[model samples]
Target: MSLGGRGDLTARIYRQIRDAVLDGRLRAGERLPSTREPAGRLGVSRDPAGHAGLREAIARHAGVARSVRAGADDVIVTQGAQQALDLVGRVMVGPGDLVAVEEPGYPPARLLFRSLGARVTGVPVDDEGIDVAAIPDAARLVYVTPSHQFPLGVPMSPARRTALLAWAERRDAVVVEDDYDSEFRFGARSLEPLQSLDRAGRVVYVGSFSKTLLPALRLGFLVAPASLRAALHAAKRLTDWHGDLLTQAALARFMEEGLLARHVRRATRE
Candidate 1:
């Protein structure tokens, strides 16, 4: 929905509720709790450390420690994976810089790179994910959905993953690995993330809870190389000082208590 439409709906709902309460149609005292009382009961702070809990939760969920050897400091919370991509684009991409992406790929990503004044080249994908050979040497960033490729649902082969990393290393370029929908692998064993295979810190791993949990939550994170963390964090701060604290705190408790793992298992079964 557009922002204007959402605002109109919210205003309409509020007016309806207010009118009902003011009339005798709705019993506000019995139906609704006092806002002032609830406000006093809850303690809220705008600490960036709130993102730390979320970062840790993402690290545990994605197996960053064991699989990618990344620590909590490597993670930066974003509004969603889309924003994470935007931040990476802002940090690494410049006008006329080349960005290689799959031909039949995620449209928003392609649009995003273009919005940043990047020259996006579409590389074809077969059963083995994106054709690394098609990527130009001048490309500064390569965006890919390695696990369960978007629309096609083909996992990038281990050999392709290694070759992509090697190409990035040789060209001093960056690879943005969007591990979307990897958690729901139904049959085959999931391959290790490119981030895990990368030894030269060439991969920026991005993941989102929108697919696994709920899209309304709008929570996602990026695991970047130590060298890029400061710039990425600055980008995040400029974009939005931080994400929702209450949601992050609640999610932290959920993951720490093992509820998230249980939910994922149950979801997979169903």
Candidate 2:
């Protein structure tokens, strides 16, 4: 049945309960937890990491636009890029692990790593992006806003990108590439993401809809290597179980219809 209003929503829920009872899945005295599960039931089922269609859409979009090497299985939908960082940290970070971030960088990222018991340190950024040489040798993870550097608006130079990837490989560390706000570039050629250049699976590319679409949407995704998949999924399940499936479905349809590209073009022009 079509859900046109509150009445329709109620009727849909009622029908689901009725069907559950009929199937003997729910006993007569059993009570529903009365949470967002109702909404999940109202639409498609949820995946702890993300909806499958949305994951595929993200992979296709990033592969084409950003040259990110990812498949649908590598994409994990997140509450936002912040949660993507959180998941990465949960899986990779440990107490006393050194986490490097750009100086004068994103505060939330620094704070998040610190909260996870990581020894978060800020490495200075020059016109070339983060100074990779200054990053401590013991640092196991480096977070960078390379495409359009946070607050600085400087793109990481090609040499710097190569150097960062090399450093990560040498240290056996991970790099979290926050490619936020690259969609709105006006007069510059886009830089290839670190994830695209990372042959050793050292980079995790994160993107968000908060800047592209709407902040209230709370939509974001991360593209990670195959090795991190199982741990990332487990972290996602432990953190929130899953995101809003209906919104994910809507975004997937939007991307599949090519509306997102058109919208970005129009928005960039304006």
On TM-score, the leading prediction is 2
Give per-model TM-scores. 0.81, 0.84
Identify the leading candidate in terms of lDDT.
Answer: 2
Residues 1-270, candidate 2, lDDT per residue (tens digit)? 122233344446667777889999899789865647876767633468787778888999998888889998899999999999999999999999999999989999999999999999999999999998899999999999999999798899999999999999999999999998868786677888888888998998999999889999999999988889889999999999988978987888789889999998888889
Q: What lDDT does the true structure give each of the candidates?
A: 0.81, 0.87
- What TM-score, to 2 decimals, does candidate 2 have? 0.84
lDDT for model 2 comes to: 0.87
Q: After superposition, how far is residue 252 of candidate 2 from its true place, in Å?
A: 0.8
- Given candidate 2, what's the lDDT at residue 177? 94
